[model samples]
Target: MDLEKRPREGSETWVDPRERPAGPAVRREPDAPEGCLAVAIRIPVRIVVLVLVVPVRMLWDALVVAGRFLNDTLLRPLGRALLWLGRAVFVWPFVGLWRYVVVPLGKALGWLGHVLLVVPLVWLYRYVLTPVGHAIAWAARGVGAGAGWIARGVGAALGWVYAWLLTPVGHAVMWVLKGIGAGLAALGIGVWTAVAWLARYLVVVPALWLYTWVLAPLGRAVAWCCKGLVWLLSTIVTGIGTALYWIARILFVLPALALWRWILTPAGRVLAVVGREVWDALGHAWRVAGHISLALGRLLGTLLRWIFVEPVRWVYRSVLTPVGHVVRDAVLRPAAEAARSVRRTTRQALAAARESVRQARADFRRMLFGEPRQPQPVDRREPSGREPRTLGSSTTALTKD
Candidate 1:
């Protein structure tokens, strides 16, 4: 091949072939493996297996054996011993404290509180507070009854006055006022009717007559004269407009219409027909393109289903899903059960702690305040009204007792 004479001129940079010395051609060599790969290949398989695989297998076996031995011999016993110790040292003591010591103490305190505090409070309320309250109530009732009797007498006098004297006077005054109001209303009505009649005759009638007889005719004559002038001007304007319309129709409109009807319409029809044909061709092409696009889409969908979707689905269903199941069974389920057990145990411990705190608080209160006082009901029923007595007399009688 004439390499120098070839399309070298098309490029921007040029070189003089005569001035440049040609170098030796670089002969391509066949690719060979690297030195490391050659060494790996040359090494004995038995030696490689002995150096790399045997130790790993031995380590794996040792780990398995050691784990089994530790679990069976050491871990299980240790776990059992820890569990037994925890129960004996912590759990049993807590249970016994709550059951025996805390519960009995609470019961005794409750009973003692009821007997010492509640019984005395009940007795004092019944004897001392109840009598004092009754005396106060009786004194208040006597004062209220006296005031009520006086009020009733005054109200009766006022009611009698209103019913007999004030009511009749108010009715008579109202009757007189109603009669006066009726008379004044009738007088106003008669005066208003008279004024309306006088206004109709004196003002409204004369105004109607003047408008009917003189002003209406004068207005009609003036309107007619103005209408005649307006009609004449409008007629002249209409004639001018009609003449211009006809002139435009003859000069421009008719010719334009003729041009459009004969030349443009036919040409437009031909162009429209050509356009319809071209549009149909383009539409057909677009339809074919759409079909091609649809086919390509279907093909792409099929390819995606085969290449990506089906393989992914298969991996999920066969590999990942089974692995998930195995993980759940081997790791997650046991971990979940352990968590639940721990949570239940923690809740029980917390509940017991809370109960112990409540008991301790009650014991502290009993120690400090000498147990809780119970409320006693006071007898609130009134005694017979026939046996009314003063506070001083009753107190003296009690002192003597």
Candidate 2:
């Protein structure tokens, strides 16, 4: 405050320089109004829309155009190419599947057809061939049978012809020769008989008489000498016989005693053994006999029943029935008819017998009296008293009549 040096009444005094206010304080601008800020934001947004959005829209439109062009041009061809490649990839596998599966199935079906055809063929061959072969064999057998029969017949006929024709001729020739031989034998036998008789009567008779008369005496003398010698020889032989008989008796007795001593000691054991053997043999024989007897009895019973009873029964049924019928028809009926016929014939014969006897009596009287005395010379004609003509002339005349 000084009026220049006077202090100003209301003014404050300045402080030290250090404490003085710094240079003028910088003023800060005032915050804008909300409406104004809004107005400014709207204006920038409008400008940004004009500047960015229009260009982006134009670029998007171009991209869209480019994508549509790419879809139309490149993508369609690529898709078509991929589809073709996929089809190419699968085609070979499909062909291989058809070859592996379908072709094998076809071959299997063909094999089945072959089996079906072959099986029937084999069956037909078996069935038809066997029967046909059998039939052919039977036909061959029949042919053989026929040939055998023909051969047998021919052989039989030839044998029969030989037997009947040739054999009989040969037998007749042999018979004639046998008859001639028999005659010759008879003649020879007669000759031998005569020679034997002549020899016995003529030669042997004298010889026998000579032997009896002469040789008998000589034989008796010689026999007397022989008897004397025999008596001497008998004396010598008797001495030798006595010695030999004693020696033989001693030898034979010794052997017999030895044999009895040796054998008789074991006789009981031997007999026991023999008895056992005999018992076994007897038992065996008994069993065999029983078996045989049983078999034989059965056989005999069967034979008796078959041969005797069965045959008799069969004969009674078979033969007797027919035999009885035959007897009735053949014998009884015929005999009955014969008896009736005989009776009828007898009756008829009896009825005709009187007339026959009368006729026979008349004939007998006529024969005895040289003709019945006819009415003597009824005077129908003159009696020619000439003797009757000779039998020869009358026979001739009767023969001419």
Candidate 3:
């Protein structure tokens, strides 16, 4: 299909468009030409609105004026009366209480608190606590000084003893060791000289004669063999050491140098050359992934809107919300009213029961106890010329009566 020439109502040649009824043309007035008299004579929108709304505006202004007059005449006086009454009834007493009672009481309390608590605390801190702390500190300082003096004296005594006795003892011991060592050395030299003379005359002369007569040639042959063996082993050891030295140099040291020179240097250069490219590629990939993620999120949001949100919103608006309103009005409202009535009835019953219980208690008390007697007033006057009655005379008179 050719989208540009698509048909709206018909399929033939894809050229048909929808036909609809047309209403009569209603034209707007063209704007007045610039610098013309019509442009200069244009009425303001506010003026037009004012002309249209004059009666309503006048009515509103008259109402406002009447309201203001009424407020000023009646409400203002009433409000002032109420304010005056409030001041007289509530504010005056409060002010009096605060000024006369509360202020004086607060001042007294503050003075008492300062005198009883704060002043005592200050005195204690100043006199007792400070003196105690200073005394403790002085005692500690004196004890520390005494301890340090005693330690110094003890150390000096120990140093003196070391210098006087221990030094001489150590020197004497060292001298004794040197003398003993000299004596031992001299004895060892004499013993060695005697041993050498004895061996040379008694043993060496005979050994030399025997070697000259019988063993000299054999000894020379054995010596020659030993020299040859020693020379061969030395050569072998030297050759092995030289070989090992060259092998270690070629394998470990030379390869390390070559690796540093060739592989590590070139690898560093290559890494430097390609590091930026790799970083850029990674950054570009990250941005592309981020864009894809955002696009996916938007697409998912659109799909969710279309599939779930719109349907849920439609159902709520069309069905659930109206149902909820109906339920609230029909069921919940009546239930709330019934609950309030029940609560009121329950309160009335409870009050009636409480009254009945109180009446019953009062009746029970009246039944259990007879009427209580009222107390008589006492007469305290004494006769003019009579002495006060004694306790025995009063008791006898009461008995006679």
**For this target, which candidate reaches the highest TM-score against the unseen true structure?**
1
Model 3 C-alpha lDDT per residue in residues 1-401, reported as the tens digit of each score: 11123233323333112322366534344432333332222323223333444445445555776799999999999999999999999999999999999999999999999999999999999989999999999999999999999999999999999999999999999999999999999999999999999999999999999989779888899999999999999999999999999999999999999999999998886665455434544443444444555566588779999999999999999999999999999999999999999999999999999999999988898789955678996644333356765654433545443
lDDT of 1 by residue, 1-401 (tens): 11122223334333344434589534334333334433333234323333444445545555776799999999999999999999999999999999999999999999999999999999999999999999999999999999999999999999999999999999999999999999999999999999999999999999999999999999999999999999999999999999999999999999999999999998897666555545544433444444455566588779989999999999999999999999999999999999999999999999999999999999998999895678996654433457655554433445333
For model 1, the stretches where C-alpha displacement exceeds 4 angstroms are 1-262, 282-286, 374-401
Q: Rate the local accuracy (lDDT) of all candidates.
A: 0.77, 0.74, 0.75
| TM-score of each candidate structure, all chains considered together | 0.31, 0.23, 0.31
Expressed as tens digits, the lDDT of each residue in 206-306 for candidate 2 is: 99999999999999999999999999999999999999998987899878887888887578656665555455444434444445555665787799999
Deviation of model 1 at 106, angstroms? 52
Model 2 misplaced stretches (Cα beyond 4 Å): 1-147, 233-401
For lDDT, the strongest prediction is 1
Q: Which clashing pairs does model 3 show?
A: none
lDDT of 2 at 78: 92
Clashes (backbone N, CA, C under 3 Å), per candidate, total: 0, 7, 0
